[model samples]
Target: MTESLRISSIDLAQFSESRDRRPTERIPLTTIIPRAWIGFSQAPWRFVGLTALMLITVTGLSLISKDLQQGEGWWQSALSDVLFVATIPTTLLPIVALLHLADQLLPSIQSTAQNEPVQERQRLRWIFRQTTSLVLLEGVILIGGLNMIRIIGALIARQSGVISTVVLLAGGLVLILWTLSQTLALPLLVHHGHRPLAAMEHSRRLVQNNRLKVLALLGLLIGVNLIGLMGAFIGLLLSIPFSALLLMASCRTQTPWVKDSRRNMLPT
Candidate 1:
């Protein structure tokens, strides 16, 4: 019994030491953004092509919608709505490509950390399978949340005007927080093979003490993409991948996966 107790105590100490050695440092936006640009440059042509396609589809849809608005028929509105729904899946295509790019880039980043080359090839079939589920899950979550918020807003609006304003503000705040919490979900899913709910939980935990940094990174990506729009939307081809790499870098730096690798290297 005494020997068992001693071994348990020693194990606890080792566990504590391992936890202490894990990096809690956040990657700076400056580092991540620049590296993201480098990653975009190195990305495969397929990713770039997909991004371009999405941009073209969106632009074409916008033009069509504008033309439809100039017409005066009940069918015009119905057609516009149909076009809008069709565009939703197109938007997910770029996102799917981004996630695959991030997953491919992660091993290189990890290899750099370990000072060793990690050769891993991305399977196109796997990427497609994973991306389909992820896109569907995200679509459901976003659509469901927006609908709930809309319903709540409507119900509040039926009450006092001032109260309705407060409710709307609160709802918006909640939505923002929820978004921030899930910022790392896609990366977690892609890199760690976590399920939808698990990935979201992991993301929430990872962002717990680093919400501000995450929000700053998100803002930086948005600003960069907006700037890209200045170049006739052609810049989005670069910005979209760049932002994805930045997000992946952020996730890689914060996750405990690297520390786990280090622990595995230690004498057991």
Candidate 2:
């Protein structure tokens, strides 16, 4: 079916629940998030629980940022880096601590079935370690070995003026896309018990034609996150929690197959 028609006729509620019932089909992000919100909203407390977890993690981000602004020397800078690294553990701990709540992220909409929570958690840990272990390992490995490379590159780039600005904008866009592509696998990893690469491939497959749409969503996420940064303490206190509510809301639309199957199953 065509994309436009696919969206136009899609029934989001049925899409969410039925998708999970299928043993082996891909589920779109559009389908998964909305359906969960329906149930989540009915109880509301579930959403509060979900929002609270996100709030704590975002709170950690705000806390470390303060120390980072104070570091000025080699030792002071090193201390700041250590504080920064410490925060990573804080952001993800909520998800790990309350595995049951992760369903908030998983849409009722799923296609094809995959369940390997034990394996998935192990994989999630590994992937987090691989991708993030190095943000700290980043310090140990490349920090001293190529210390001047970053310094020299900055100096050379500074001389390019207008050319640098244009190039930087292009580079920034590319980096954002890459980061989103890499991290897109993350929600799936948590929700589907998917291994890292499998989750990534799955995310790419579902989002293929919808890359622009997905990217727009990513841009919205980033914008909200940036706003959170500016809000800092207040952001942690309210912005992240509020944003999670909005995220749940915005993610609540329906998909096609679920509507079709529901129509078939219901007696007229």
Candidate 3:
């Protein structure tokens, strides 16, 4: 099926919940990266264009914030602080949007077939609801946990420098693991119609059995983004899409919704 038609026809609620709960096979990076590359290759400019737009907005706000901070006025500093805070959402919104787009676009590029039809308006509404709810839920949990860790670290710092350092390191490690475990939550929600908390729970479970592979995938994506950072952030235009595509692809492989007979034939 054509990409647009396939995307439009997807019924998010039709996913097999039983299969979703089952353990996903570990997809080799060898298969994932090339498939992601091909997916991106098929439609580079749209993804790149979206990233470029985000980059511009983020960069512009950051520069404006810096300038405001340097200005000789109290209100200027306050406004700069607001702008600085705005940058976080500015950065996150694009990423969430990109992931939504990648989720829709990737399956067709990968030649996965689904047969359901929904209107464009309905799809947009579904995506918006899912994305917003997931963002709010995930953001609160992660931020709350990190803040608690920070508070604990601060308390420890008063007791002993070395011990505080150790505590902070351990806490950071815990947060990293927690973050990794929820990596698939967005894909789960957008692709499979999972509720926010349910998606997070499922993602945690999925990551638990495949911790090492998930870690490797994260490391690879991080390295790619880091490389992109070195190029004056222009590389993010490509790297961001590549990362999103790979992530969506990995999620699909791990929690496929196809029939039993076709499971073995899926591109892993």
Local distance difference test scores for all models: 0.69, 0.50, 0.75
> Model 1, which residues run further than 4 Å from truth?
1-30, 44-47, 69-77, 106-165, 254-268
Q: lDDT per residue, candidate 2, 1-268, as tens digits? A: 5987778567665788787765333223443334444434444555456557666656666676667668676776676667676666766554443332433433443422265778656755664654344234434533443444445446658787666556556655654554555434545454555665665665555455356666666675677668878967555433344334333333223345654433212111
What local lDDT does model 1 show for residue 37? 56
Clashing residue pairs in candidate 1 are none
Question: Which portions of model 3 miss their true places by more than 4 Å?
Answer: 1-25, 107-118, 150-170, 254-268
Assess the local accuracy of residue 197 in candidate 2 as a C-alpha lDDT between 0 and 100. 61
Error of 3 at 107 (Å): 4.2
TM-scores for candidates 1 onward, in order = 0.67, 0.48, 0.73
lDDT (tens digit, per residue) of candidate 1 on 149-203:
7788788788777887777788778877877788888776766767677878778
**Candidate 1 versus the native: TM-score?**
0.67
Cα deviation of 37, candidate 1, in Å: 3.6
Worst ten in a row by lDDT for model 3: 107-116
Give the C-alpha lDDT of model 2. 0.50
